[model samples]
Target: MLRIITEPTEAKTELERISGRTQGGETLQQEAAVREILQAVKRVGDEALLDYTAKFDGQVLKAEQLRVSGSELDAAYHQVSREFVDAITLACRQIKAFHRQRMPKSWVQFGQDEIVLGKRYNAVDRAGLYVPGGRAAYPSTVLMNAIPAQVAQVPRIVMVTPPGEDGKVNPAVLVAAQEAGVSEIYRVGGAQAVAALAYGTKTLPKVDVITGPGNIYVTLAKKMVYGVVGIDSLAGPSEVLIIADQQAKAVHVAADLLAQAEHDPMAAAILLTTDETLAKQVKQEVEQQLRNHPRRLLTEKAIAHYGLIVVVDSLSRAAELSNLFAPEHLELEIAEPWDLLEQIRHAGAIFLGNSTPEAVGDYLAGPNHTLPTSGAARYASALGVETFMKHSSLIQYSPTALQKVSNAIETLAKAEGLHSHSESVRLRREMDNG
Candidate 1:
């Protein structure tokens, strides 16, 4: 059953416990295992990928079969329905449009004495996208990860996903990848796939950045390979924190919470409300809805362990709690949502008004759904075109500009006891003077 906390101290303690719910001691052991996998792939490349795929995924694959053929890409469209294509196409358009606005522009500004200063933004040569495969086929994840790289104009975008026992990638996932302009895909996943992308196998080229969510192993692999290549944030399980008032419908609130809980057994669904009566109603509604749920076993596990409800005295207190958690998804299902939004300081994504569920953001809402989790919203942001591109500082100084600052540069360089650093500036000034 979902627990409700009335006391502020208990609520704080419970929220902290949930935020740090990730495995503690087991993580060290897992990291050691992941390190072995990474080193194996780094050493032998494609051979290691094939060996690991067969061992972990229970599907045997040959080196030639690692990369998905062009014929398979064509066949994927036929495998999925037209409705899915149309829907994915629309999502592609929406996501592309949204990220296009987020593309960082290269700019230069002239300053006094003809000093040039700005930044130059450019896309990475190649980008690797990891799409998790197991519980469900995530076409949306393909769009969310791929479209941003596409908008950033990443050249040679490649995808990696685990194949089914039949050694076939999910049709909808392939279709979404193609729709989002990623056709170079491989039928591989897990830490080995991450290793291949990072270390560069003979079949899979090394990528500049890897983006997508996966299980603990994949997350650890990304963490390990971060210095070798750029990556999106270390994504944790999905979570939603809903602050609803009496005006919000109990059924709607319950459905929204369940939507998050259904993602995984570790997913969290929390609600903070000013109305105790409404809180009770929502709890009952959640149980009533779970009775006939298809994923009841997993969803119930999530709700029973990570789910929570807190009846606060005011909406301000609710906002305070929500900020403290820094949830991946935050919904304001209250009368004056905009008014309350001002009080919110942290959250990966915020859904305003009663109608805007996290599902909309998960699907065709245009914003990238690849958001920070596990309190990372305190310092991080959602994945976007910025993830696939990098900026270089642009600096150029005229002879006049160099002369003006040469003495100060020499003084600072001498203070640091670096003769060559001081000489470089001194020579430029002397040449101009001579």
Candidate 2:
């Protein structure tokens, strides 16, 4: 059962438990394991990758069988139902549209005397996306991670996922990748997969950036290899904060909270409501709904460990607590959601009204579902075209423009006691004068 906190003091304690240190107590061990795996991959290249695939994923795949071929992708499409294929295609279109609008555009401006300054946006040469494939198939993840790279015009988009016991990738994932326009797909995952992308193996090429969520091992691996290669974020367990009022439906709120709870045992599901009666009702509803979910065990563990229902004095207090938590997914299930929306200052993604559930954003809604987890919403944002592109500042100064700022530059340089720095500008000024 979820903890019920009524007093402000209890609320603070419960909120700490919910938003506190993420999947703690494993950082050092995870970092060590990741370092070992990364070093092994770095030393042995493709051989180490293959060995780890067998040891961890239980599939002994050769280098030739690592990359999924065109025929295999076609077969994967045939494996899934037509409805699923159509749904994937539709999702691809929606995600593509959302990212297209958010893509940064290069711009140039011509100032007087050719003192031009602007920026140019360019996509990375290659991007590697990791898709989790342990308990469930994540075709949606494939679409979320790969579509932005496609929209950003990445030259090559490669995806890595662990193969199943049969040494085959999930067909649904393959179909989604094909729909999202991925350039390559590999059968690898865990820290080994991250290593393969960071330091290119004999078969897998090193990528400019890696994106997507995974378990602790994968997250730590990304963190260790950050400078060697770019990573999206050091994602932690999933989290959701629902701000509801007496007018909100307990069942909907409960279901939404459980949606994130079922993601992982460390996942957090928090409910902030003004009505004590509603808080109790929603807690009961969550347990009742859990009975029917296939992942009831996992959801139950998550709720028992980190879940909480806080009864605040007013809706404003609820909003304040929600902002403090900075949850990955925040749902406003109240009478006037939009009115309270202005009160929410932080959150990765906001679901307005009862109809707009977090699940909608996860699947078909035009927003990228890859969000910042573990209070990261306080600063980071959801995955988008900007994540896959690089920005370069453009600057140009003509002789006249240089002359306009030469004196100021010399004065500042001289103030810093750098004679050489000032002399560079002084020399140029002398040439102009001559």
Candidate 3:
């Protein structure tokens, strides 16, 4: 059952607790366990990956069978329906087009002193994509993570996913990977899979960056391996904070909340509304909808523990509480969504108007669905092409340019006690003068 709170102070306390759900003390044990998995993979490579797959995923895989075969990739298309293929193709095209617009270009600027300065953006040599597959198949995640890397022109895009107990990867996931231009995929997941991507197994190539969402073990592994390889973000569970006005439909709002809750038991769904009646209605509606939910036990646990509805004085107050939460998905079911959007400073993604739901963004909306969770939206953003690429500062100084700034450079270097630095500038100027 969803809880409804009318008191603002109580609502804030509950919101804070929910926002910090990922940082609970229990993670210390999980982190330690993840560390062992990482070390094991780093030390033994493919041998360790095979062991962990058997231990964690309940599937025994040979070193040779660790990588998904071309025959399986071809069969994935036949396994899935034409409707799924068509939908995935549409998502791939839409996602690729959107990311193409976001691709950062290398630029150079000629300054007053003929000093060339700019930034050069280049894709990493290889990128590893982690697609979670436990409760559901996330072909959308495949397209979301892989398409961005493809658009960024990452030379090699690799994917890794956990196989089912039958030791078969989801056909839909494989089809999505193919549509998104990810040809190299491995049949492995969990912390060990992350380590293999970061440190490289005999079968898996070392990648420059890893992107996607996963369970706690996967998230911990990504966090631990960040310095070894770039990561998209330490994504927490999925979350959504919706602000609904009187005009918003109670049933629609409740469905949106449940849509997020169904992702995981730790996922959160919240509502901040000025209408007390609507808040109560949504609360009732949430329970009503969950009665026959396909994922009832899992969604019920999420709703019972983390789901909340708060009745506030105004939309401004709702936005204030929302900013404090920094929700991963924010839906504005208000009459004037834009008016409230100005007050919202932080949110991973915002859905405006009653018709717009977070599901669209999760699937085919232009923006990336892999967003920051656990209040990370305050500082982080949705994963995109930028996650698979890096920039280098480009600088060039002509003789005249060096001469003009040599004295200042030498003074600054000497002040810092870097004699070689000062000498380098002075010698350059002297050589140019001669």
- Candidate 2 lDDT, 303-390, residue by residue in tens: 9998888888888998888888898999988889999988999899999998999998999887988898777788999998888899
Q: List the residue pairs that clash in candidate 1.
A: none
TM-score for candidate 3, please give it: 0.98
* TM-scores for all predictions: 0.98, 0.97, 0.98
User: In candidate 1, what residue range of length 10 has the lowest lDDT sum?
Assistant: 20-29
RMSD of each: 1.0, 1.3, 1.2
Candidate with maximal TM-score: 1
Q: How many clashing residue pairs appear in each of the predictions shown?
A: 0, 0, 0
TM-score pick, better of 1 and 3: 1
Off by over 4 Å in 1: 23-26
For this target, which candidate reaches the highest lDDT against the unseen true structure? Answer: 1
lDDT of 3: 0.93
What 10-residue stretch in candidate 3 is worst by lDDT? 22-31
| C-alpha lDDT of all candidate models, in order | 0.94, 0.89, 0.93
TM-score-wise, the better of 1 and 2 is: 1
Tens digits of per-residue lDDT, candidate 1, 1-434, equal 98988999999988887888774623678999999999999999999999999998988889999989999999999998999999998988888888889888999999999999999999999999999999999999999999999888888898999998789999999999989888899999999999999999999999999999999999999999999999998888889999999999999999999999999999999999999999999999999999999999999999999999999999999999999999989999999999999999999999999989999999998998999988899999999999999999999999999999999999999999999999999988998999
